[model samples]
Target: MPYEPLPDLATLSLAEIAALNDARKLPPVAQWNPQTSGDSLMTIRADGRWFHDGGEIRRPAMIRAFAGLLRREGDGRYWLVTPVEKQSIKVEDAAFIATDVAAQDGALAFKLNTDEIIVAGPDHPLVARGTAELPAIYLAVRNGCEARINRSTWLQLVELADADLTAASQGVRFALVPA
Candidate 1:
């Protein structure tokens, strides 16, 4: 798919943001139930770099294609699934990084490193981990995958938060601080 610039979230309503998010058509990895399983020899590093067999995958298109097929099982293992095979891939941290964020009309819109946009709401909730002083906030992406809200983006959320350190979006409020 060709790259398109993201619209200004600040100028868009929640409904518009949701439309922009669902515009992209992803693969049906969730519905694929392959009987073959093995290691993919791929790793997503903590800093969001993807490596395959000791070599870095420098192509953005390849990364995006692979990310579309990523799925996380109930056992906490990451896999790249296809119709014929499902291969486990190691993830050092979250599968993707929340690179940018914007507060839309009563919504929190996030931009992932893979150029995917998602709105934080009931279906895609924000989860806080670690400690209050050093929190790790994550946003649910898709198919049980999540994007770790990077430091700068997390700080943006902090600035948007109320006195209680809670950010509200789509009638759901999330605590910025770990509890």
Candidate 2:
């Protein structure tokens, strides 16, 4: 599906902001406690794309909705949980892609493929994962979920970091670290 950027939240009405946030919020999957009945017929690709059965899930909004419903159990397993049922889903790597970034006053914020936004702060730490030679950078999403930072975004982040250097950031090397 063709993509359109989300409208600026600052310009939106209070009701509009509430509506957008409500749509992004998923049901309490963690508290549902549904029996693990079956595996989800879905796989998240290494490049942060999702597929079901076989074909790609091309709708960003649909993908965003599903992402909100995803959960990770204590045993390092993934599931899509609703009030009625819980089902497993395969993740080749991370489940999300950090597609866009914005920087303000030395702080970095990200926009996901699903249109959700997060700042790379305490709750949303940015780190590089994967091998040293070819790292997969990530920004934390809600819970324990981490979104893979794409190459272009990573480059932009580097540029921002360089441009907004501070004494604390001086010599604070940002390198590929395990996620």
Candidate 3:
């Protein structure tokens, strides 16, 4: 049998994506420490564990936050299965997929799917080069603060202060209320 294509979240209108989030059918927001620092550039505790830079929710709490939306199979593993790409990825293991990586502000962002994982190299167009840490940013709108993640530091989280994290991803952003 031929393989079917998954649904692309980016293709949907903002309103449509909002509807999906409203219906609780989308992935839960990842958690980050809001109190750590407000710099866009920061270091993440890549000891194979997620930490909150300073936001409301922290690591373990983040797991609960992502529970249903993104399931944890076993150990400290979580998967994001997207219909559009018909692919699932292990959140912690940043090795399996050869993602196109990029460093913006302080966030080490990856763009991956079934086809490829693009790791943003030094030569990548979006690599942020500087010694001063970027400001710590969060996703905020008329409603309130949404999700938060730390910036990147060679191999750590950069300490950013008073920065806006609205451009974390291309996907529509949403505020996750703890249950």
Candidate 4:
């Protein structure tokens, strides 16, 4: 007997994919798969600034609009997809950076450069990648992308971190959700 594997992606129709991208409230970026037109000369800086054709995109609304369409593929690539086209975009390290952060009730909340607020607590955990002495903080962002914690926010988190963290098992742990 021969064994066959199930196909991925549920085989969504083209029109359905388009409709999904059109609807508001975080379009199904993880689902749609239109043909790749080509790469756009856009690069999202590590500081959460979006640039195109070597010019900084200062319009907050435009950046926010594009940020909504950002997606990460299984092959470790980033793309900005629409109903009809999927354009590749360069990400310096991670897509967005945490511009602001606040703590309340023993949990941390972060505001990303895209103006998306993420409460880093139980549902969306904050994963630390380095020593507590020099930690690289990251918050789970949309579709498997992580937003790096900025310097100021990192400082604040470090100051507020629990003192009982073991040396071997470093990194902040909490959960929040949106992405």
Name the top TM-score candidate.
1
lDDT of every model, 2 decimals: 0.91, 0.70, 0.30, 0.68
Q: Which stretches of candidate 2 lie over 4 Å from their true place?
A: 1-5, 8-23, 163-179
For candidate 4, list the clashing residue pairs, or say none.
Answer: 121-174, 121-175, 122-175, 123-175, 123-176, 124-175, 124-176
lDDT of 3 by residue, 9-67 (tens): 33444444344446543343233112222222212222323333433224443443333
lDDT (tens digit, per residue) of candidate 2 on 1-179: 45556775334544453466565546776687886569889998878788999999998777877898888777777888888888888988787888877653444556677787666666566676677567677777764677888889777666665443211121233443343
- Pick by TM-score: 3 or 4, better one: 4
- TM per model? 0.94, 0.76, 0.23, 0.74
Rank list by TM-score: 1, 2, 4, 3
lDDT leaderboard ranking: 1, 2, 4, 3
**What is the C-alpha lDDT profile of model 1 across 1-179, one tens digit per residue?**
47776766566777777687677789999999999999999999989999999999999889998999999999999999999999999999999999888887788999888978888989989999999889999999999999999999999888999999999878999988888
* Residue pairs clashing, model 1: none
Please count the clashing residue pairs in each candidate, in the order shown.
0, 0, 52, 7
Which scores greater on TM-score, model 1 or model 2? 1
Error of 1 at 126 (Å): 0.5
Error of 4 at 129 (Å): 2.2
User: What would the per-residue lDDT of candidate 4 be over residues 105-130, giving only the tens digit for each residue?
Assistant: 44455667776666664455677676
Candidate achieving higher TM-score, 2 or 4: 2
- What TM-score would candidate 2 get against the native? 0.76
